[model samples]
Target: MELRDLDLNLLLVLAELVREKSVSKAAENLGMSQPGMSNALNRLRALLGDDLLLRTGRGMQPTPYAERLAEPLNEALRLIHGVVNLEMDFDPARSNRSFTIAMTDIGEIDFLANLMRALERVAPDVSISTVRKGESNLKDELETGAVDLAIGWLPDLNAGMFQRRLTASQYVCAFRKGHALDKGSITLEEFARADHLVVLAPHTGHMMIEHDLGRLGVRRNVKLRIPHFAAVGHILSETDMIAALPGRLVNHSIVPFNLAWAPLPIKLDPIPLNVFWSAKYHRDPANQWLRAMMFDTFSEGAPHVSPDQAVPLP
Candidate 1:
């Protein structure tokens, strides 16, 4: 269909319909009547010559055609919105902007509290929301403006994304404060002999430390596997199962559990913690401020371990 034939307003209806997935809900969001939303949907179907949405037991599901349009449509709308607002200057002190970030449970534990405290003093009107990072779709989410920033050990970001390294993190062995290993430096044999609790990231179903151990032909006696790092502290506090976690996550000042940590006995390269954003928002004033705030917060507060501290197994 020619651009001249299309109603730009219909694109807004389509975007809301795709997001809300229900005509009534989309209408409510757009402040239009249900009949009006249905009429808009009909117009969109005729324009595209495809069924955009279908009814399913779960709810309204996007058809293959609708799914194909979802990303580019959102990106286009975001760009248009950005262009329209390009002249407005961001005043952090007065603006009540909300930012959505994608990160792991570990990141929430290590970064959020401190960052919020800092923002409370400087950008009191701002709000924050967080979503879990999906391994496969993180790049798409950023590009589509679903999330403003992603923070973690995201090593495989897509080419067009911009990343700034926050710090290099190394694994540390953590257990209850009074655990035997806490009395002295842990040895490789002792570490391997202990029952362990491991984290398998929900999106990737991979455990970085386990993968590293496997490569070195060193395996731990893993007794439990969980999907969130937040559970590690509580589990380690009550059970004999220790965990290998990023050092920043076990810092006593931030974590509530009565835990003690030591450098891993086996050598592993430091993982680079990065803040990732799409080049699309690289120069956007609000986005730039948030990125700078994140960089400053993490770089100053999060723990870092130098490469010289990594100890090799015998």
Candidate 2:
């Protein structure tokens, strides 16, 4: 069917329908009556000459054609919306828009507290939410603008994105304040002999600590293996275990947990922490404002985003 023959408003309903799947939920999401949403779906079906969604035991499921249309449709709408609002200014002070960011627990400790404090001084009305970095759909979420920004040492998000280096971090041997190796330099043999608290978070750059150490023939006497960094400070502070973690995290915890840290015995590449946004929303005024805020607040060394560096993502 020709584009003119179809009512453009129905496309909005189609987008919501395919996204929500259930007509009732779509109607609620779009602030329309359930019957009105059903009518729109009926119109869409008649115009498209296909059963766009079929009801089964698990509620409404989109047909293959509708499923295929979801991404492109959302992308087109996002671009149109961005263009329409391109000239509008984003006043963070007045905007109550909640931004969702993706980061690891270590990032929450190292950055979130300071970011929230900065927000309170300027953008008090704005709210923030966080999702873990390793979510399987993280890239898709960022591309669709569902996630505003992703931060930390995310090497996985390298392709099809705009990134700004926030700072450089390196692994440090963190232990209790009174530990034997806390006073001075720790020898490689000492690090190898000490009890280790290993953080085993996958899809994060922290895993490289073990890989790098092992490559250099340094074996850690692992006493405990945890899946996250949230409790590392507590565990290390109360016990004699040493954890090889990002120096920033250790520094941030030092005051509160009485932690002490020294450089790792082996030299490894510095972990580059970055703030990433999808190429799709790179031109979005709100996104641009947020990116600029992040760069201004956290960037210590790297150059800022320039027109020459804004590349497209797949």
Estimate the TM-score of every prediction: 0.68, 0.67
Per-residue lDDT of model 1, residues 1-314, tens digit only: 67898999999998899999999999999999999999999999998998899999998999988988889999999999998877647888998999999887777877888799989988999999999866578888999888899887676674788998876667778898888888646888888999999888854213666678898988789899887777778889987878888777777433578887777787887667778999988888999999988877764444455555566866
TM-score of 2: 0.67
Stretches > 4 Å off in candidate 2: 1-86, 299-314
Instruction: Show pairs that collide, candidate 2.
Output: none
List, residue by residue over 90-203, the lDDT tens digit for candidate 2.
Answer: 999999999998888987877777778888988999998998856457888999989999987777688888898888776677899999998756777788899999999887
Whole-model Cα lDDT of every candidate shown, in order: 0.82, 0.82
